[model samples]
Target: MQSSIIIADDHPLILKGLNDFLLEKKYNVLASAVNGKDALELIETHKPEIAILDIQMPYYTGLEIAEKCKALNYQTKIVLITFEKDEAIYKQAKSLGVYGYVLKEFALTEIEQCIDTVSKDIPYFSPELLSYLEVESTPKELETLTPTEKEVLKHIAQNKTAKEIGDLMFISNRTVEKHKSHIIKKLNLAPIQNSLLIWAKENQTLLE
Candidate 1:
């Protein structure tokens, strides 16, 4: 049986393109909305098997809509469409019980796979994000962290700059930087790509 799905996006091209693409993929495209309000309404009304919502939408963001659905105990699976691959966003999506996290650029390449996975009540994240789960996300790597490094990691996840962390920790900015470097080394994250921050954002719940 074809999967019944609803999609929403502010961009006209994206809304139509996704509609056509899902139809071509043999999904039952129940409705497509150009704005967020309609998206939520359609989902509430139709209760399709899945709802694919763009992250940045007018009135209510996709995340907000997902939250509402969770509160209402709606059974429709949610797929968050986003250009941002931030780990913090992923964390929030996970908390919201989001089923799929597909980057806009990879929609054509990954959406079908994402929906297929979510259709079975499994969660799916963007392709590029899979590496983080293995890199610094291993339980052994996390276990190697000391108390001070863990504090710094929490600050990084909270979006605090090094200077801010230094002020809070009563340390010099240079010392903070050293600690950050150590944290990255221990986590096996890259030094240049802000990978530490990414890991922090994506794994906030773990730190808590």
Candidate 2:
């Protein structure tokens, strides 16, 4: 049987583009929705095998729908698409147990593979999203940190523990650890004990 899919996005162009693409690729597009409420209705009515959802939508966000689906034990796999490059939102999406997290910029090339992977009950996150989590270094590295990265990195450099960072951020200690790991990797710091704190000290200007 051809795999069935439900797609929803607020932008008409984006919603149409994805729907057309999936149809061109021969998947059974059960329905397309312009908002989260309608999307939920279609899911409950059609029970599609996969749901390609936009992270931002009227009535309910994709993450919210995914959580509801999980609560109801629905069989649909969720793949969230978004244009925002945000670490916190990505963490939230992962926490919701979404089947995929795809950036709109990479959607055309990657969505096909994402749907395929999700069909197998595996998760897929865009490479661009993963790249942001990787360690990169330049002479002016501190100048390149995002606001969130700078905040977390600053705390680490200040000799704050993961628990302390989590308390400050109102996030879990595990989340703090994840951020710390990403900071170390992104700064391209040598994998040695206390390397991050040392680098943090060396680059105080960037954090401050």
Query: Best candidate per TM-score, number?
Result: 1
- lDDT by residue for model 2 (144-181), tens: 66778789988887889889988998999988888778
TM-score of each: 0.65, 0.64
lDDT of each: 0.86, 0.84
Error of 2 at 37 (Å): 0.3
lDDT by residue for model 1 (61-129), tens:
999999999999999999999888677788799889888899898898999989887876667788576
lDDT of 1 at 36: 84
Model 1 lDDT on a 0 to 1 scale: 0.86
Q: Which portions of model 1 miss their true places by more than 4 Å?
A: 132-208
Q: Best candidate per lDDT, number?
A: 1
Clashes of 1: 0
Worst 10 residues of 1 by lDDT: 130-139
